[model samples]
Target chain A: MADIVLDKVSKSFPDGTVAVRDVDLEIADGEFVILVGPSGCGKSTTLNMIAGLEDISSGELRIDGERVNDRAPRDRDIAMVFQSYALYPNMTVRENMAFPLRLAKLDRATIEQKVAEAAKVLELTPLLDRKPANLSGGQRQRVAMGRAIVRSPKAFLMDEPLSNLDAKLRVQMRTVVSRLQKQLGTTTVYVTHDQTEAMTLGDRVVIMRGGAVQQIGPPQELYDHPANLFVAGFIGSPSMNFLHAAVEEERLRTAVGDVPLGDRLRRELAAEDAPRELILGIRPEHFEDAGLVDEQTRGRGTEFEAPVEIVESMGSDKYVYLTVSGERASAAELEELAADVGADGFGGGAANLVTRLSAESTVAEGENRRLWFNLEKIHLFDPSNGRNLTLHEGRAAGALAS
Target chain B: MAASDTTVAAKWRWGLLDVVVVVFALVPVLWIASLSFKTTGTLTDGNFVPREWTLDNYRTIFSTNQFVRALGNSIGIALIATAVAVVLGTMAAYAVARLDFPGKKALVGVSLLIAMFPQVSLVSPLFEIERSLGLFDTWPGLILPYITFSLPLAIYTLSAFFKQIPWDLEKAAKMDGATSGQAFRRVIAPLAAPGVFTTAILVFIFCWNDFLFAISLTSTERSRTVPVALSFFTGESQFEDPTGAICAAAVVITIPIILFVLFFQRRIVSGLTSGAVKG
Candidate 1:
């Protein structure tokens, strides 16, 4: 219903702690934008500023082209679903959902009708008379959603709204949230620390770190081309494998093996400022069991042999953890990413690689397995700065520059 | 079989303990009721139950304007003091629980110190000040002291209750198109009702049962409460004992306290905020 613009909006507490800084975001009308990051990354703070729950220390916030920096949350016409659900326990489901409408001074009939419609949409018609104490966690979550949608506010700000559900319920409610957002066509700004939610729920994902916007792009675009080492590590499951690489003549010597530089990589490496030492990043899915790859596909990538440490079968694929002779990837950004996951010094300095192979492959633990990695998909990062050297043109450069 | 036997023994032990506590608490109350129904001749009899029951004691107390006016003063002063204390305490306790300002901890410490201070120590100074301020021997005289002494207790209890309420509900209300005032009244105040009621009952009881302040502050029947009036009670004749009539007034004043506890006890015990947030 409205486009939300946060132009260099920042939030700093009186004690001189900056919660969010220079966060510039432009969410189009009816667009579902997700702000994702680790805990204390300022994603929730930015969402609060957008919802008018927190004051913006600097810059402007506009809704539908009107500057609303001074507007109260009620005047801004926004609805927020808190992580805890925050249901009015004193009110029944019907009254809880009808709260916003009643506050708007809607007539009795219209409030009842709107609440009924929202309850039906959320499949909470059966629970209209029940208090929240009698409802299950998922039902309480739906009531929170119903409360937000009943009034059809200008935008919906969700702060980890689905994080409280069980794993199976979370998945079920993810689709429900997706469908509801699509049906309502309301501009939504959702904040979550869960990267999977960011990947699946938003039209565009805005990744943040240390109060600054890191990258903004569609899910697949960010997955395919992350702007930096943090995005590369933060966006994927099992995360992208990082290995220290030493640039040599026409080749990059890494812990796994010497990677022959293709023309595209060579072109980027030829820049005068390119470092002699770099970091190579490859996603887990990029590695396939060499025995299962076809001749044509095998020819497009490089094959290396390593001793497999563990093999985990995940129905459709096998996650193979392999160890090779090299030092682990070391960089400030990589350390911060590891610490974000409470994985300080994970796997030691053994230079282990996590590869996803076809489930049919017979790569058992303690066996030397030849893995094929797609060369074109490999990303090279500057060791000192964590910049992706291979991202040299177009949207990626623009995203990184921000 | 042994475990079941031990569990049965434990239940019996607890049941016996419960009986002891009930008897300990109820015996004096029943004794007072028994005394109220006794004739003046049997008032000192050694029997547990009244030897000769009579309606004469109740009839005597209600017949006089002295005891009736004192009862009226008790209700009026206690009700006003409780209402004012709860209102002012709720606001102060809410600020203590939720808001951060300079000297917040100091305010809490000071209120707590006031709660721990001896009320008997303030009676003399209060009597002097009330007389100079023209508050002596009036409802406001007793009501003012009652409010001041009970306010700290109300604030402490209400603040503890307010601390458990999730702050998110208020923010959610605001985002749901409610102004700050509406958010508090519609969302917060209702959730805080049990605490408010609990604090109100406590303040009421404190004001109702206060003897020192009532006796010290009032010198006339116009403002004397039941407890102070009982001390000043004279028999039908100077030689006659007023024990039966005094016991009757005691039972009457106790009825309101019992009713208050019975009426709002359920509200005080309900976990009204249990489902307000994710647990």
Candidate 2:
């Protein structure tokens, strides 16, 4: 219903800690945008600034073409769903949903009609008279959602609304939220630390790191082409494997094998004045069981043999962890990404490569297997600056330029 | 069968301990009730139970205008003091628990220090100040001191309760189209009602049971409360004792305190803030 624009919005504490700095974003009318980042990465701070729950120390926030940086949350007419649900414990379900309407001074009959409508949509009509304490976690979450949607505010801001639910319930509610957002067609800005939620839910995802925006694009674009070392490591599950590759003339010598640089990469490296040592990035799905690949399809990529350390059967795909002898990829951005997930052993000197093969493949633990990695899908980053040296033209310039 | 035997023995052990505690607490109260029912001649019999029962002592206190006026003053002063103290305490406590400002810790520390201060030490100074302020021997005279002394306890108890309430509820209210004041009145105040009720009861008891200020500040029957009035009771004759009348009055005042605790006991529970947020 409203378009929200954050023009160079920044937040700083009195003690001189910058929580969010110069965050520039534009959310179109009825668009669902997600701010995804690791903990302490200022995503929540940016969301709070948009909600008017926290003040922006500088810059402007405008909704519907009017600046609302100094406005109160109620004045801004935006509803929020908190991670804790935050239902009024003293009120029954109907009362909780009717709270915003009541505060807006709506007449009794109109409030009743709106609440009944919202409860019906949320499938909470049967629980209209029950208090929050009596409801299950998912039901309470629905009630929280009901409260936000009941008022038909200008926009909706959700701060990890489904994080409290169980895994199966979280997935179920994710669909519910997606369907609801489309049905209501309200502009929503959701902040979460979950990349999966960001990938699946948002129309466009904004990836943040260390109080700065790393990239902004569609989920598939970020998955296929991460802008930098941080985005490359943070976006995918069983995240992209990083290996130390030293430039030797036109060939890059890696622990897996010597990777023959294609003409496009060699031209990009020359144009960017690439370093002698580079970080090679390959996603898990890009690597396949070389034996399972056909002769014609195997010609586009190279093969490397390594002893598999572990094989996890995930029903749809087999995740094979292979260990090779090499120095692990080292960069400040990579280290921060690893520390964010509390995975200290990630990118340790063992150079463990995680590859996803077809479930039908005969790869097993403790056996040396030949894996073919797609040459066309690999990314090369400069070791000194973490910039993608092989970045294609027409990508979002904000990340590459930074 | 062996499990049933041990369960029975455990119940018996608990029952015996409960009886011992009840006896220790209730014996003095029963003795006072017995004294109140005893006739004038048997007042000094040194018996736990009265030899003969009489309603004459209750009749005497009710028939007197002095006892009635003091009782009226006691109820009015205590109720007014409790109301004012609780209202002020709730606001102060909410600010202390939720807001960040200079001197927040100092305010909490000073309030606690006042609560720990001896009441007797301040009574003389308070009496002189009340007299000069032309508030002595009046309802405000007693109510003002009671509020001043009890506000610290009220603020402390209510603030501790306020800290347990999830702040997210207030933010949710604001996001639900409520102003800050509306958010507090609709969401926070209801969540804090139990604590307020509990603090009100405590402040009421403190004001009702106060004897030093009531005796030191009031010089006439116009504003004299029950506890001070109890000391002024006289028998029908010059040489007669007023023990029976005083005991009846004591029994009368104790009834209100018992009724208060019994009525608000359920509201003094601690888990009201639960279910407001995720466990």
Candidate 3:
């Protein structure tokens, strides 16, 4: 295993198009780090730079405390699993798995033994003599994984290796990949645009946008405490509901209702340089049916009644979509995220909020229902900069405890 | 019942068209075969079939040193030219398909210009140059022009095949601890073998079928290919006709082409149409 460090890594093409900006990342030995963002976010570019497939324009990349920025991909002693699997079409599974060992000049017995071991782990023993074209999609993916693990390289680099598989197969392979990485204990850098994979697979997730690293932390930390509006909206499944609000006397005046600012938020808003206008962020799971909340527990949050536009029952919970009378949050980050998720009318005047209510709640479509949003879970962001103004100093620690 | 009736009528029309096409393509070949089996006395009979068949024409051509030497020259020159062209074309095609070097477009444009250039225009200049260089009656003279003309065809076909190969395999190979050379030999070359083989057959056919260059560049049987040698065939005396012998030689030359197409027809079809669609 190797520790990979990128010090101010950047990648720019000859035509002056910057694919990756100055980004610093340190992946620990045997750590599974995921670089994730929307398409064109340069996550794959960063992984390519680490793999030495793409040249670093103006920075140093050190693997195992050795400067390897100029090293060839083979010389770097890394293995990459491509989205296309990239298995040699002419080679059988045994030959494909044994390729790196053969290239490294391993003996025949050792190469065969290692390939056999990998095939057993990947359940590809029966397919050892089958060419890649004859394998199914999942089998091809397993072969790609088998090829990567057979070498036991310094690190593993996977670029959307599961993206080509069907959703059911993708989930199955995700567990297999995670298990393999743990069994081998190799430092792995996985690049993907799917947030679910990023959250589930990586030990630490790096959220990036526009070729820039926005945040690097645990998946739960990014989920509980997003550093900016983009991460807040990008991390969660249903995504965080955003509403435009104006700072006022001891309260934030939003279109839904007046929300009383807690002591922490009041102190943050009273700062000398605080802006009068801000964006309010709340995750969908932070809201509950007001009727289900007890009196003492109800005091910890605020309640507002709105007509439910749509209700989707997902067995465990109901996703209630509500239209509140207010201007939706308008920021470049949210707009880009809306475009990324294909959420139409996100920035329209009527703010649409999706709240996950318990299955026990009897909320019907087109009926007015009171929803209680956790006040403590609310995030306030600076509209101009997209910075989460109310982000606590120990929020990441708090996320870990919860 | 109506659908079945229409299907029957359509099958009949298609069967008629297939018969017409097969007859149109095969009649000349049958005629040539008949001529090759006919005796010299029956050569001028002007009948579709020979009254009496004989293998004497084949035996005569096989016995003559002139035909034997020309046949040997044809095989050697075409094989050598094809081997050289395919190797160079593979390298050029791979680079054109995968690499981003300056003047790539210019190289493609030049090859295209050469592919479309009229061969008749270059024959005179090439003939003069070969004479000046003392390569006038050598196999190298004919091989040179054959390679030059076939390079563009080889490059276009091979490059189209190369483009269909996922470039990611090379990167994966590198990550799998393969040097660039190793990656090409182990991963790319094997994948590209069918395409290279197909291109080799095409280039060989082009060189083997050349009559003008073989005749103009060489003055004797020393380097004269079969096509040119066929023109020199005279039945023993001025009164004799060499038509049967010529037909025998033509049929012999066509055997290899027919076998190649029959063996690799599927591969040739796929190689030609591979990159036209995204898989």
Per-model CA lDDT versus the true structure: 0.90, 0.90, 0.88
| Candidate 1's TM-score | 0.95
**Winner on DockQ (1 vs 2):** 1
Which scores greater on DockQ, model 2 or model 3? 2
Provide the lDDT at A49 for model 1. Answer: 91
Q: Which ten residues in a row have the lowest lDDT in candidate 3 chain A?
A: A393-402
Give one digit per residue, the lDDT tens place, for model 1 in A62-173: 9999999999999998899999999999999999998888888999999989999999999999999999999999999999999999988899999999999999999999
Residue pairs with colliding backbones in model 2 are none
Model 1 stretches astray by more than 4 angstroms: A248-250, A262-276, A394-402, B1-3, B236-240
- Which pairs, if any, clash in model 1? none
Give the alpha carbon lDDT tens digit for every residue of A138-201 in model 2: 9999999999999898999999998988999999999999999999999999999999999999
Q: TM-score for all predictions?
A: 0.95, 0.94, 0.94
Q: Estimate the overall C-alpha local distance difference test score of candidate 3.
A: 0.88
Candidate 1 chain A lDDT trough over 10 residues, lowest sum: A393-402
Q: How many residue pairs clash in each candidate?
A: 0, 0, 0
Candidate 1: count of backbone clashes, pairs at least 3 residues apart or interchain? 0
Worst 10 residues of 3 chain B by lDDT: B270-279
Docking outcome class, model 1: high
Instruction: Give DockQ for candidates 1 onward, in order.
Output: 0.82, 0.73, 0.44
